[model samples]
Target: MFKSILVAVDGSEIGHRALEEALAVARVMDASVHAIHVVQTGTYPTLILSELEPPDIAQQALLDALDREANEFLADAEREAAAAGIRMTVYKRWGHPGAEITALAQELGADLTVVGSHGRGRLDRFFLGSVSSYVVDHATSTVMVVRG
Candidate 1:
């Protein structure tokens, strides 16, 4: 039984579904919920926007945008959790989603971590990698991958 549940939210439909599932499980177990959003900054600092010819994309500005987006996602997650009658502590950080989620879950003593499967094809996963897959393989706590 999970006493504390952690959910990774990306603001995607699948991610929202996973959050809902986490809330349901938390309700059943009377567990606390921790909702987190990680803004993946990848190699943006060194990479250029090929689409933009000049590629003058200010790395700092781009990072700021990502942070803003993450904050919005976390805010929405908090609202959803509130509507579900579940009190959830929301966190937003900039880093690798998988690693950050796992580390935070462990730090919070979460017994279970919930994530959504992006349904990426093998080829796509090979090139882009999968955060859910990484979290599932690396997390120390029990991980539930919600697929739709």
Candidate 2:
């Protein structure tokens, strides 16, 4: 019954699995699939660079690299969706992955949001913060967390 399915992919193995799972669900429900890749702009590298004098060039370069990676991830998802004969839309955002994904889902009024978990240990999750966990807690729509 999901008409719009939003999937968050990070180019990891689990992200790929999440995409596949979302596509399968979309296929079954005849839903439109939307994929989002968020380039974390607040990472340690970027933050460290920002404190330097004349950080413009370095920051831009780092952002460019992240953009390229995001594109690659979205491209793969697009190809998969094409091969699956599913209507898919893709988005790239610069922010926290979980926040961006949930915002996009709300903006698109997605009925279901799919995300992948790295299956990190409790300590790791506590320190690093889990994107899937955040999405599940914040998204207003249905959430599907595919664990790796």
Candidate 3:
């Protein structure tokens, strides 16, 4: 009986699946879907985007690129939701993914927040940290973790 659904997307396959699940639920419950993609502007970005060059690179440039990418990802998610006859609102924020997502959900008064887990092992998560785990533990709303 969710009236408002919040789905977190990171342009990953698991994230896509989570959005699909959110859409299905929204369709059944006649709920509004809100999607968010965080630009990840802290230390976590180093671990998350290891492929990128060192931190010595231009910080502003990197953030701009990340914001553009986040917008593209959100646009794609919006298109998919629109195709299903669902009007989804998407947002882009710059911060720790978990914190931003949780804050947005609270701000929107979301009834449910859906996130995708990368399914990294405990050891890896312990070292690199897990955004999904953080969101699951910190979010006030009901949470659904779509694992991959």
Candidate 4:
């Protein structure tokens, strides 16, 4: 039985389902669920919002999208955890999703990791090459991929 479970949420319906599954498993095992969303760093803030330099239209748009994604991912995860009646810990990290997920699982001492195959935002399985796949390959703990 898993004592600590790490669930990756990305504001996608698929991610919600994965969290639901993780919560159920956590409840049965009395495990603590750690929910996380990773923001791929260096992909945002292309146009500096500074007084010296005006924001570039295209870069500003990308930044806006990335910012929204960060917010939405955390908000959705928080709602899901609340509805599940589980006071789970949530993390919003900025970096490669796969690496962050694996690190969090290890850091939290999780026995299991759960994530969706696809998520919201610009990232798709084919385009992003699958974060779940990376997590499965890199994690020491048991990983379950819920197809979105």
Q: Which candidate is the best by lDDT?
A: 3
Candidate 2: global Cα-lDDT? 0.84
Candidate with more favorable, higher lDDT: 3 or 4: 3
Q: Count the backbone clashes (under 3 Å) in each candidate.
A: 0, 0, 0, 0
For candidate 3, what is the TM-score? 0.84
How do all the candidates rank in terms of lDDT, highest first?
3, 2, 1, 4
> In candidate 4, what residue range of length 10 has the lowest lDDT sum?
41-50
Local distance difference test values of all predictions, in order: 0.83, 0.84, 0.85, 0.82
Q: Give per-model TM-scores.
A: 0.84, 0.87, 0.84, 0.80
For residues 20-130, could you state the per-residue lDDT of candidate 1 as single tens digits?
Answer: 999999999999999998876563554334555643448656766777888888899999889989999998877677889999998999999999887223442465438
Q: What does candidate 4's lDDT look like per residue over 113-137, in tens digits?
A: 9998885657464465468888989
Model 4 clash pairs are: none
In candidate 1, residue 126 scores what lDDT?
A: 65
Instruction: State, as a TM-score between 0 and 1, how close model 2 is to the true structure.
Output: 0.87
**Residues 19-126, candidate 2, lDDT per residue (tens digit)?**
999999999999999999887765545545534466587777876787898899899999999999987899999877788999999999999999987522344356
- Model 3, 5-110: lDDT tens digits are 9999888888899999999999999999999998766654443444465544565577668778888899999999999999999999877789999999999999
User: Native-vs-model 4 lDDT?
Assistant: 0.82
The C-alpha RMSD of each candidate to the native structure, in angstroms, is 4.9, 3.2, 5.1, 3.6
* Candidate 4: segments with Cα more than 4 A from true spot: 42-65, 121-123
Which residue segments of model 3 deviate by more than 4 Å?
Answer: 44-57, 119-129
